[model samples]
Target: MHKRSFILTCLSVVVIAAMLSGCAGTMVTPTQQNFKAPVVTLDSMEVAHAFGYWYFSKKVKPTKGKPDNVGAPLDLAFIFNIENPNEYAVKMENLKFTVAFEEFDLNTVASTDTMWIPAGKTNQVRVHAHFDVRQSLLSLLVTGGFQLKAKGTNAWAQLEKWWTGIPEYAVPVHVKAGAAVFKADGLTQVTTFKATFP
Candidate 1:
């Protein structure tokens, strides 16, 4: 009787252990789907000359004790003509902008921003950037490229849940230019542009 009771207890333990293992193996977890951004090619670039201007306000100062005089503000603009050059339309969830002194990369740069783009379109992007006389005054400046990325979604969310599960895209900027100057601070930049289908 003792032997039979011991065997029964051992079998029960084995059964319970197997059941627990099975349940653990069947547990599910959420995961992000793999996504790829469309390939973009640069067709051409256009940049205007930077004009020098100054402004003084109640909060700021001017040169030679000038009484709070205001002058035209320094403005810089660039237009990029990009080509999709792809057969299929690419969905850009987020865009990344970066400024480089000589070479274009995430590191060894100044600032970065994110935006979005549509598919099969040649967009004309405008970047309003300001530069100041800091660091080395004689640093040679070149063009930079924006990095682009694509988001993945298995299903579309409804109006209330639309904000959920929407992935962002990243893109690179490639411009053809060299050597420029900007202000040290108080600079406002703008990039309002689009790409059209080629």
Candidate 2:
């Protein structure tokens, strides 16, 4: 009888220790996090051409100076930031995007579905934009910017810049977005990226 009780007691302790160890390695619930903005590189600007759209063809090589063509699509690519704080998965939805340079702004970009951001990481969202040359160029020109002329560009491109007012080369740019995130408690967290660029 004495031996049986001792064995039973030992077994109980072992079981308890085993259970505790197992629980220590268990996963925790995830929570919601805020989105972070990434630094954008705007130093090198080029006007590349696509046959039909921004990805259609390499019809024109990347040229510097000023962009003045009323033809082809314009390609602009940049990397931005998104941050998730919780261990739980956050579902990103309802993204509103704006791409602006100085006083020029475009509010036409939209996303239909949600983007998944895993827990505890700042995800870099690299955006490659395809803009209509006619609209984009005309926008800058009409907003008081002069045609920028790069040395290697052809004369037609040089003469073609539609901006007629006194040229302002220095412009500030902004890429902002309003994002909504689904959190752990079935709650919605909304955040905005609000910064202007050099």
> Who wins the TM-score comparison?
2
**Candidate 2 segments exceeding 4 Å error:** 1-72, 137-171, 180-185
Measured by lDDT, the strongest candidate is 2
Residue-level lDDT tens digits of model 2 in 1-198: 999999999999999999998886685544334333222222322223234322222344446544434455445554556667666456666455576643446444545456667767665555455665456645555643443332344323422331211122234445655343444446577665545544
lDDT of the candidates, in the order given? 0.33, 0.49
Q: Assess every candidate by TM-score.
A: 0.29, 0.47
Q: Judge candidate 2 at residue 72 and give its lDDT.
A: 52
| Model 2, position 20: C-alpha lDDT score | 91
Least lDDT summed over 10 consecutive residues: which range in candidate 1?
159-168
Give candidate 2's error at residue 187 in angstroms. Answer: 2.0
